[model samples]
Target: MIRTESLTKRFGPVVAVDSVSLHVREGDRYGFLGPNGSGKTTLVRMLLGLVYPTSGTIEVMGRRMPARAAEVLPEVGSLIEGPAAYPYLSGRRNLSLIDAIGSRDKRSARRARIENVLGQVGLAGVDERPVKAYSLGMRQRLGLAAALLREPRLLILDEPTNGLDPQGIREIRDLLTELNKAGTTVFLSSHLLSEVEQLCTRVGVVDRGKLVLEEELTALRAPTGRILVESPDADKITGILNGRLVSRAGEHIVVEHEDAAELNAWLVGEGMRIASITPERRSLEEVVLAATGPGADRLDR
Candidate 1:
């Protein structure tokens, strides 16, 4: 649903976003990942046409960006940096005002739509308390409700779970998953590897303003010709596969093998009682760290 080719943005002499190409297909829960100041926000802004790129092109839903933002943005929902609201106004009032802008929906249905999104984001019980009285998590939920107000075909979220507790985070995750399953394409940008690992189908890693790696989550997490085994007869197995054994810690062992099933069958055939055997795969954390450098927030001497 979104595509960018060598898209770049420069602030004076600093290139906040270098030549980066991004692809987010329809119905994809694509995770755009990078550490602080790695150009994730900058790139997201460029995609939404909020920040003009220094060069290159952006296309959303088959239409060129900035030029076609008016035509295309209506179908795209985004939460960038963080959400904003009139602090003195109640959340409901704030939403009512936002829902009226450039919205073609019938006025009669506006209240129901607002209430539906508020409930979706876990703010259904929110009172008439002004936004200044709401907690950080509440504000985050308000932002999400605003994004869902229109039920856009594409969602672009940045640090979507920034201020929530675990339960809130899980709720939002489930909501996004449900939306994606129902055919809303999601482009999620965040520094949280675990969250992305659990929610995203595909991932792109950016480092120092450059796109470094792009791959399907399954492909990136493929088994690496190794097996983890837990057996009561650990010593016996170790002795039999001494050359192939990578490590042994009591009953748990790591073996260098290409096929886990064959090894399991061979062990069973040899009358070695087995407890468990499974192929070892790289975690998402390892893959992302290898692709990106230290975050910009880190200082080195």
Candidate 2:
């Protein structure tokens, strides 16, 4: 649904996006990730033609950008930065203005379409409230409602859950999942790693204005025989397990060759005290940090 080739953006001495190539397939709940100043927003701006690329190409829905921006934007929905609304306007009025921007009129078909989206984003109960009165989470929902006004084929969201509480965040997460399940392609950027771990199928990690790693979530989470053994005598435990494939990682002994049962039996038989034994998975945060930290360019999927 989206593709970029050697895409770069520059501001004199600094490059905001650098030769980043990415592919977001149809129906993919794609997660774009990086810390502040990593150029995720700049990259998305270039894709939306809000900023022109320094070099290279961007394609959305098979149409090249900057050239076909007008033709293509209608089919793409985006919520960048944050929700913007006329503070004096009521929530319903806010949506009516968005409806005016597009040629399609959902007015006749929807209980005004405004109501449908308000309900979709869980704002129907307060649809008549003034924009100034809505909470930040409510405003975020309003932004999503505006994006959905035209029933777009592709949704581009940056920080979709920015102001949401736990429940609101879960609601948005479930909404995105349902939208993807119903055939809408979702491309979202977020600083929330746990959210991405639960919601996204594919991930792109960017750093220092460069794309460092792009991989399926399943592939990025490598399976391992690394079981964690935590005890006060972790050092002594590692010495005992050294005959097997074992290594010390902080206060834990990571046993590679022995299963939990074998390791526990050996520990008890050797008269060593044991605290807990558990299998460990390399977390997505670790993978992301390794990819986007110093020397990020050296990493790959």
lDDT for predicted candidate 2 compared with the true structure: 0.87
Which ranges in model 2 have alpha carbons more than 4 Å from their true place? 104-106, 229-242, 245-253, 258-278, 294-301
lDDT of 1 by residue, 1-301 (tens): 8889999999999998899998889999999998788899999988888899999899999999989999998898889888899999999999999999987878779999999999999999999999999998999999999999889999999999999999999999999999999989999998778899999999998898999999999999999999999999898999899599999899999999999999999999988988999999999999988998877888881
TM-score top scorer: 1
How big is the positional error of residue 252 in model 1, measured in Å on the Cα after superposition? 2.0
Question: What is each predicted model's overall lDDT from 0 to 1?
Answer: 0.92, 0.87
The TM-score measured for candidate 1 stands at 0.96
Per-residue error at 183 for model 1, in Å? 1.3
Model 1 residue 155 distance off true place after TM-score fit, in angstroms? 0.2
Give the per-residue lDDT digits (tens) of candidate 2, residues 157-183: 999898999999999999999989988
lDDT of 1: 0.92
